[model samples]
Target chain A: AQSVSQHNHHVILSEAASLELGCNYSYGGTVNLFWYVQYPGQHLQLLLKYFSGDPLVKGIKGFEAEFIKSKFSFNLRKPSVQWSDTAEYFCAVMDAAGNKLTFGGGTRVLVKP
Target chain B: EAGVAQSPRYKIIEKRQSVAFWCNPISGHATLYWYQQILGQGPKLLIQFQNNGVVDDSQLPKDRFSAERLKGVDSTLKIQPAKLEDSAVYLCASSLDSYTIYFGEGSWLTVV
Candidate 1:
């Protein structure tokens, strides 16, 4: 069974702190990676995605993720966090030929202003 | 471009009651998906449809749950005699292609 794992369950950081949420997938074959964020009372939205491209992919809202094939990881990162950045982040992966996504348990980030 | 739309932002029903959720995918999107998202967990794919045909439904609980995407544009998912564990957000998503999927504001269901 293919799965995605997010190492941190809850992360608390002060405003302006750097953020990194670890995400690893179990599949070894070609995969499409994605990071989605759900803010309080908002629907889930795409933060970034990685396909066949440069390992580093940048997305909206100052978010970025790196797809490291060797580690089977696609970790999301943000240099400076704001209180508005507090949200639950989910990492997801899908096989190259599949339309279904396997998502990891989400990481809840709280940024204290 | 309008995004995927879902009905009944929230619903509360007793165990054994029945409920249904409706979704309308983006115009011209061929792929539609239904996912169940429990609190503190990621969204789990329940079913997928390509146009009006079922592409994958391996995760759907066909015994008590059923879904249909009629006309390849709108869809409905229903649960009969809902269980307590059925309390979760039912998310509807659609994609033009396999890579760029978009999610709707999910229909939240609480079975007490």
Candidate 2:
């Protein structure tokens, strides 16, 4: 069975501080990776995704994720954080041949303005 | 385009009661998914349908949970005799050609 792990459970940062959320997955075969965000009282939305080619993927709202296959990691990062960035983030993975996603324990971020 | 649509934004029921949720996917999307999200955890995949055909449902609790997409457009998920642990947000999502899934405002269930 495939599983995802998010090392950070909760993170608090002041505005303009850098941000990084660790994500690791357990899978032996080809996989598709994704990062999703859920704002307070809002549905989950895609932040970024990695299917093939180019390990670094940029997404909406100044978010980016890098897929490092050798390390079995796809970490989300932002150069500077804003108060609007406060939300819960989740990392997900699925086998290349499958459509179902396996998500990790989410990380809740609180950005203080 | 319209994102996924779900009805009954919230539901409250006692243990051993029955509850159901409905979802309508985006137009032209072939894949629809149902997920259960606990208060502080990530969403867990419960079932997936590809145009009225089940693509995956390995994680669904079959003994009490049932779901169907009859016409490949709208879907329904039902829980018979729900448990306290079953209290969670039921999320409905859809994707075109199995890529870039979009989620709807979830149906929140509280099993007392």
Candidate 3:
């Protein structure tokens, strides 16, 4: 079965700290990768997605993710974090068929002001 | 454009009870999806519909779960004889094609 894995279950960082959330998928074939974020009591919002082309894709809120095909990873990164960045992040992948997204367990990020 | 909408925001039901959730996808969208999201986990696809036709229901527990998209517009998801493990947030999403999936504020279901 295809699956996504996020290594860090919980991450705490201070404001202005650099952040990286690891995401890896277990599928060799072509895949579409996505990163989504959910603030407190809010709906899931798309942060970024990699369909094709440039491996490094920039998304909303100063967030970016790089898709490394060799590693089968699309890790999200942010240079400077803000307190408002606190949220639960999820990594998802879909195969070439584009049926349904297979999501990871998710990572809880807490940024201290 | 308005995003997908789902209601009620929250529900509390007893075991063996029947509950239904309503969802209105983004206007003119041809694809719609329903997902079950347990606390601390990502959303799991329950069923998908493409203009009133079932696209996939492999993950849906059809024995007690049923969903329908009539007229290829609004949709409804129902669970009969709900179990405790059924407690989770139900999410509804829609897409123009298939790559981009926009989700709505989920309906939280708590089966006690």
Candidate 4:
């Protein structure tokens, strides 16, 4: 079974502060990774995804993630965040064949204005 | 296009009661999924359907849970004699292909 591990459970930062959330998966084969965000009372929305190709992938809302195969890590980063970025983030991974998706516990990010 | 649609945005039922949730996947989508998300945790797959046939239901508690997709379009998930632990959100998602799944606003369930 594949599992995703997110290091931070909660993070608080001021507006304009940079943010980074660590995500690691336990899959040994070709995998597809994704970052989804859920604002308060809102449905989950896609942030970005890494299927194949370059190691770095950029997503909406100025967010980006680096896929390091050696470490099995796909850490999400945002150089500057806004108050609107306050939401819970989830990291999910699925096998290349597009099987079941495994999600991490999730990281709640609160950006103070 | 209209995204996935779900009904009964919220429901509160007593223990041992039965509840059902309905979902309509995006048009032309061949895959539908039902996920259960407990508070403070990510969504977990309960059942998956390819068209009108089921693809996976391994995580579904068959003893109390049941789901179906009719005509390869809309889907319904039901829980009979619900338990307090079943208090969570039920999310419906769909995809044209197995990957790139799109989600809908979940239906919240509270068992007291």
Candidate 5:
């Protein structure tokens, strides 16, 4: 069974602060990775996805993640965050064999204004 | 284009009672998924459908939960003899293939 682990449960930061969220998965084969964000009172939307190429994938709203196959990690980073970035972020993995997407325990980010 | 659609945004039912949630996938999407998200946790996939056929349902608790996607479009997830732990958000998602999934505003269920 493939599982995802997110290192942070809750993070408190101020506006203009740089942020990095760690995500590691326990899979060896080819897999697809994703970062999904859920704003307050809103549905979950895809922030970015990595299927095959480019270790570093840039997503919407100045967000980016790097897929490191050696470490089995895909960490999300944002150089500067705003108050609007306060939300819950989830890291997900889809194993190529079964194609089942498994999500990690989410990280609730609070960007203080 | 419109995203996935779910009905009955909220429902409250007593224990051992039955409840159902409906979902309509995005137009032209062939794959649909049903997920259960307990508070403070990420969403878990309960079942997935490729058109009218079941693709994956390994995590579904078959004893009290059942879901069906008929006509390859709309789907219904039913829970009978609901338990207190069953209270969570039922999220419906759809995708053109196996990759990027678009989610709907989940239907919240509270079992009292």
Candidate 6:
């Protein structure tokens, strides 16, 4: 079975600090990667997705992720963090033929203003 | 568009009781999914529906959990004889094709 792993359980960052959340998946076949964010009381919102294009995918709110196939990783990163970036981030992966997604244990990011 | 819609934002029930949650997918979406999210964990896929037919339900606890998409528009997930461990947020999502899932405000269930 496919599974996703998020190494960082919780991340605290000062304003303007660079952010990176590690995500690794256990799948060898073609896969689709996605980053989703959930605010305090909001639903999960898509940050970005990686299908077949370039490895680096840009998402809304200055978020981006690079899909490295050899490493089986798709890590989320942001150049500068803001207080509004405080939320729970989840990394998900789906096999080519599977419609279901396997999500990693989320990482809570707290950005201090 | 109207993302996805789920009713009963929160539900509380005793163990061995039953509860049901509904989900309305985005307009014209063909694929819908139900996920169970425990506190401090990412959502886990419980079931998947491609229109009115179930595509995958390998993770669903069939003995107590059942879901259906009758008209291919709205879906309902029911948990009979719920247990304390069944307390989680039930998330509904829809996608146009296969990827890019749009999620709704999940239904939180608390099984005491």
Candidates 1 onward: DockQ, in order: 0.81, 0.80, 0.83, 0.82, 0.72, 0.82
Backbone clash count for every predicted candidate, in the order shown: 0, 0, 0, 0, 0, 0
Q: Candidate 5: misplaced stretches above 4 Å?
A: none
- List per-candidate RMSD values in Å: 0.9, 0.8, 0.8, 0.8, 0.9, 0.8
In candidate 5 the C-alpha lDDT for residue A14 amounts to 100
True contacts kept of each: 0.81, 0.78, 0.78, 0.75, 0.69, 0.86
Give one digit per residue, the lDDT tens place, for model 5 in A1-113: 88999999999999999999999999768999999999999999999999888899999999999999999999999999999999999999997743678999999999999
Interface RMSD in Å per candidate, to 1 decimal?
1.0, 1.1, 0.8, 0.8, 1.4, 1.1
Give the TM-scores of the predictions, in the order they appear: 0.98, 0.98, 0.98, 0.98, 0.98, 0.98
Indicate the docking level reached by candidate 6: high
Which 10-residue window in model 1 chain B sums to the lowest lDDT? B94-103
Taking all chains together, the TM-score of candidate 2 against the true structure is 0.98
Q: Chain A alone, TM-score for each of the models?
A: 0.97, 0.98, 0.98, 0.99, 0.97, 0.97
Best candidate (score: DockQ): 3
Model 2: share of real contacts kept: 0.78
Weakest ten-residue segment in model 3 chain B by summed lDDT = B93-102
Distance (Å) between predicted and true CA of A9, model 3?
A: 1.0
In model 6, where do residues sit more than 4 Å from their true spots? none
> In candidate 2, which residue ranges exceed 4 Å CA deviation?
none
lDDT score at residue A15, model 4, on the 0-100 scale: 97
CAPRI-wise, candidate 2 is medium
**Could you give the DockQ of candidate 6?**
0.82
Per-residue lDDT of candidate 4, residues B4-112 (tens digit): 9999999999999999999999999999999999999999989989999998899999999999888999999999989999999999999998878899999999999
Task: Supply candidate 5's per-residue lDDT for A49.
Answer: 94
Tens digits of per-residue lDDT for model 5 on B1-112? 9989999999999999999999999999999999999999999999999999998999999999999998999999999989999999999999997788899999999999
DockQ score for model 3, please? Answer: 0.83
The whole-model C-alpha lDDT of candidate 4 against the native structure comes to 0.95
What does candidate 1's lDDT look like per residue over A5-79, in tens digits? 999999999999999999999986788999999999998899998888799999999999998888999999999
